[model samples]
Target: MSKIGVEQSLTNVQDALRAKGYDIVELKQESDAQNVDCCVVTGLDSNVLGEQTTSIKGSVIEANGLTADEVCQQVEQKLRH
Candidate 1:
């Protein structure tokens, strides 16, 4: 699965993704970098869901923190496969 690290609040992003019909497998908050918050999303690949093992990592850096809309847009772009 592809994992994405968003520079924003996980709650906000998760809610937005759920609203967009994306299944949220997991959400984790990690340490901040330069005062910028970060969160990780697991289970991103459609092929890997309840199947073979796979991993991908994506990062989004936003100064004021990423918005839910921005996170969904970026994730959609990356998950186009």
Candidate 2:
């Protein structure tokens, strides 16, 4: 199972991903996102400072205006590549 980093605010998404058999890691801090294959965020704090930092090479899935299922689908697609 691929590891996934999920924002603490997204409880629904965490449950949905867990049901799908993915290894879910709660992203509490900057280092929490380390080693995960994909990350799910609420898109609230991203790009706020207009500065980008490269901590992980995996894809970042923004959970804004999308359902858990849709986010899961994107996670799958991103992992495939």
Candidate 3:
């Protein structure tokens, strides 16, 4: 079970990912991403991620403008690689 950190502003994608068995964590601050394998975000909001936006440890997924299914697909692919 991989953990995914989602920017707080992008909560819409959380439910969809959670159903897929990914452990979702709300990324309110940099510390929240410590244990996550990937960070899903909407590129529209840089401030929402603080400094973590630029230097995320794992893959940084830009899900903005994508549907929930699209977002899930992107996340799924990232986890695979």
Candidate 4:
């Protein structure tokens, strides 16, 4: 499971990800000056969780108001190794 906090309108994005079999642990709404918004999604591998490892962690920051595709692409590029 992962913690995913997002703004109001990005529910579609969240839903889409969940449909793809992601473990969503949490979600929250946040405000921003520009329509562009961001959400932080954190994921941990099973081994890390089982071992209670604090060193292994991952995060993705998804933004909106800019093109959703672009935001997602950027997030993917940044987060994926």
User: What do the candidate models score in CA lDDT, each in turn?
Assistant: 0.45, 0.88, 0.83, 0.40
Mark the regions of model 3 whose C-alpha exceeds 4 Å error after superposition: 52-54
What is the Cα-based TM-score of model 3? Answer: 0.86
lDDT of 2 at 4: 96
lDDT of 3 by residue, 1-81 (tens): 989998877777998999898899998877787878898888887666577444656788888789888988988888888
Sort by TM-score, best first: what order?
A: 2, 3, 1, 4
Over 4 Å off in model 4, which ranges?
A: 1-4, 29-57, 66-75
TM-score of 2: 0.89
Instruction: Report the number of the highest-lDDT candidate.
Output: 2
What is the per-residue lDDT of model 2 for residues 1-81, given as tens digits with 9 covering 90 to 100?
999999999999999999999999998877778789999999998852234664777988999999999999999999999
TM-score of each: 0.45, 0.89, 0.86, 0.38
Clashes of 4: 0
Please identify which of the two predictions, 2 or 4, would achieve the higher TM-score against the true structure.
2
Superior by lDDT: candidate 2 or candidate 4: 2
Mark the regions of model 2 whose C-alpha exceeds 4 Å error after superposition.
Answer: 47-54
For TM-score, the strongest prediction is 2
Query: After best superposition, candidate 2 residue 33: deviation in angstroms?
Result: 0.7
- Judged by whole-model lDDT over C-alpha atoms, candidate 4 comes out at 0.40
Per-residue lDDT of model 1, residues 1-81, tens digit only: 333443223567767766776655443222222122223333343222233342334443231355668767767765663
Model 1 weakest lDDT span, ten residues long: 29-38
